[model samples]
Target chain A: MSVAMPPGSAFLPLSVSLRGARLVYDDLLLFDGLDLELVGGSLTCLLGPSGIGKSSLLRLLAGLAPRGMSGHLHDGSGQSLRHQVAYMAQQDLLLPWLSVLDNVLLGSRLRGEPPDRSRALDLLARVGLTEVAHSRPAALSGGMRQRAALARTLMEQRPLVLMDEPFSGLDALTRLRLQDLAAELLAGCTVLLVTHDPLEALRLGEHILVMNGRPATLSALPELPGAPPRDPGDPALQAAYRAILRQLDAGSR
Target chain B: MKARLWRALLTLAGLLLVWQGVVMLGDLPPYIMPDPLAVGVRLWRDAGLLLGHAAVTALEIVLGMLLGTVLGVLSALALGYSRRARRWLLPVLIASQAVPVFALAPLLVLWLGYGMGSKIAMAMLVIYFPVTANFYDGLRHTPGGWLDLARVMAPEGRRWAVLWHIAIPAALPAFGSGLRVAAAVAPIGAVLGEWVGASAGLGYLMLQANSRMQIDLLFAALLVLAVLAVGLYFLVDAGLRRLLPWHPANPATLENG
Candidate 1:
């Protein structure tokens, strides 16, 4: 059964804008005067080369930017939005001992709110993991583990979700399936997905941003026709992929 | 598992046989190296008295281990969370270990008196270092990615919640390893305390038998002590394995973990 979020229970969509974010690690200038914004309730894809600071930018937006960064992340509401974020890192950081269902409920448990098991189980079903709800993370395959992590991210009910190469480790088939599921499940939430695959970005992003340079800059790509889980085999997506690849190659040089 | 147990039993029997042969061959007096049969007879005859002393030693070990584990966890928390504690208390803790810890037995007995309190304190002293060192290493060395995720989840920056959820759970296997080391060495502290001043426990019995020239009975007390140490170790190992079932059950896992 599809679990509709109870009225007034789901988070109100948040708009995030970062201005003059200055993050330097050790001696390397990661971001100097970087500015970006995520329109409320939209999935924004970030694409770049291996080390072009896309993930770092996401961290900056989440207010988890590295220490000694001078910047303001204004949640257009003029308030701290850190508590409203859910981050899915490159590695599925599922607690090893917690069962799949409990892992999904971790955010609520941490907040001292009683877990809504029905909602968690419904999310697990959406991820096609109903069978392993009672299993520990180590018992699941790599793809299943990531699925479990995705379920956990969804359970947080947060409006702002930051994902860093979340599906890059999966096989192509599982990756495609997860991309479709994520696009559908996170419909009205603000999402920033960091990925290396241009096609995956074209398939899932409403508005894609390519970040590159010594001090980092974010430039937007044109919006595609429809919200994604867009047809990966479509000609338009292929053209966008080719154009984005060229943009990334040019950025690296 | 059954095969390993059988092999272990075989090895023990072979060692006993060799000991009997060596005693017969060397024509050694019973006072120097009593035959295994004589020791076994003494064990059977004095089982009641030996058990009473064994009970005291076991109690002291259990009490000290519980106290050590709690204190060690607290100290490790301080070391992990605070730079000042890391700098000042860490060196003091290490320096305490530098002087032979067993040498503190006499002073502990004098201070705490010749009772279970001194023995328990001695065991705590011996048990604290490894637990603190291993647990602190685990807490400080959590993966960067996990820490970042923890930060993102708790935007209020609830440091203790992050530590309880992410840091402590991640550090559990290391804590388990520390406890195992503590269990193996637990008997040492209690026996040392008894040697210093106690009138009860296996150590006192061993000393009494030694002075009376009851070699077989001394061997019996030594065997009882060995069994207690081995039993306690296995108990801790079994409990830890249950607690951390997700831990890879292999020799390589332990080496890395």
Candidate 2:
């Protein structure tokens, strides 16, 4: 389904820089003076082994990093990045009580702003969730629930989106479809996606970064050719995948 | 549903048979422990008197539940929303539970008089804690993911939005639990107040029947009170189920269906 962009929905994408980021969890350093940067309006996939503070780095960018994690986050606009960011987590996190439509409008409702119902419905329709807009999240399938979550994230109309393994919970087929939908919907917005899957990164990321080791540091791999939602069977993508696997394997040791 | 009802009826029948067996085996006098049959006969004979007293007690319990729930919800919201209120009111709320309602019954009667007012207050006092404590716990324990979502979604200085849209709704099932416990114990406060000082209610009837050695009538009163408490509990449970359609009390049953 072709997703229609909401009227006047163009966003000025924000480039974020995190420097001297230090996180000590239970006295074990996670990120010691780590530095990273995101190019404006590009999807950057961060792959790391479990417990390597991948999610924490995304949280730091979303301004939700745990207390005692010292860092400087510059959005290059001399403004706080909090208002400019939208976050999507592994779980759909749709409030069970709210209908799909209400969940889409949640960002507006939470901000105490008047919700544009027609716009929310339009977003839902784009995500192919028009029929179940009035149904509760409990009534939705995992894929449909994430679609609704994506709609909610889009409703925020933020320039920077940080997603932590947002599609990892879905079945392979559903996850692949959602990656395409997310790529199409999140175009022109700077995104930091943290994932454990190499293929997911190869399929969606414009720039792939691997974070590994004690006091984890980020290393950039060569940028993939062509746009995201690239074919998984493509030889270049397969080659990138093997390289990422080797990098992750080396990081573990 | 039909099967459930049948099982409930069977259980009641079994309990009644046990009561009758005990009385018969003990060769108990009617004054000491009237047979189940005697209690049933007394219930039929004094149906009008029993119903009147029951109405009084039921009224007290219902009114008390309403007042207590309102106060409890307000206090929960206060405690959930304000750090200052949580610091000051939480201690007071906990202390209120520590003071037994039985000890407070006499004071309630003295202050609110030997009428429905005292009984209602006693019932309210009995139930207020469960409702407040349960709801506050619910508010405090809103899922971390949801709160994180709210922190990102809601504008700064609009904490009320998060509490209203997310925390309160998330906490409702817990609040419903508190309400159920409150409903079960509501009768205790009202009955205690009646026993302490009252001219009406089943509790008062129970007291008078005991004094007059009408053990069967006393047993009849007790039966009606049990029916009232159980009936009220089911009523509350049913109402809550309807109100919170999103919160399935038994997800397994719902899934099976």
Looking at chain B only, the TM-scores across the models are 0.95, 0.95
Q: After superposing candidate 2 on the true structure, give the runs of residues whose Cα lies further than 4 Å from its correct spot.
A: A6-9, B251-257
Of the candidates shown, which would achieve the greatest TM-score relative to the real structure? 2
lDDT per residue (tens digit) for residues A60-96 in model 2: 8887889768788988776678788899999999998
lDDT of 2 by residue, B1-257 (tens): 78879999999999999999989999989999999988999999999999999999999999999999999999999999889999999998888778776998888889999989999999998899999999999999999998888888763847888888999999999999999999999999899999999999999999999999999999999999999999999999888887788886644338567
Docking class for model 1 is: medium
Instruction: Give the number of the best model, judged by lDDT.
Output: 2
Provide the TM-score for each candidate, comma-separated. 0.92, 0.95
lDDT values, one for every candidate? 0.87, 0.90
Interface RMSD, all candidates in order, equals: 1.5, 1.1
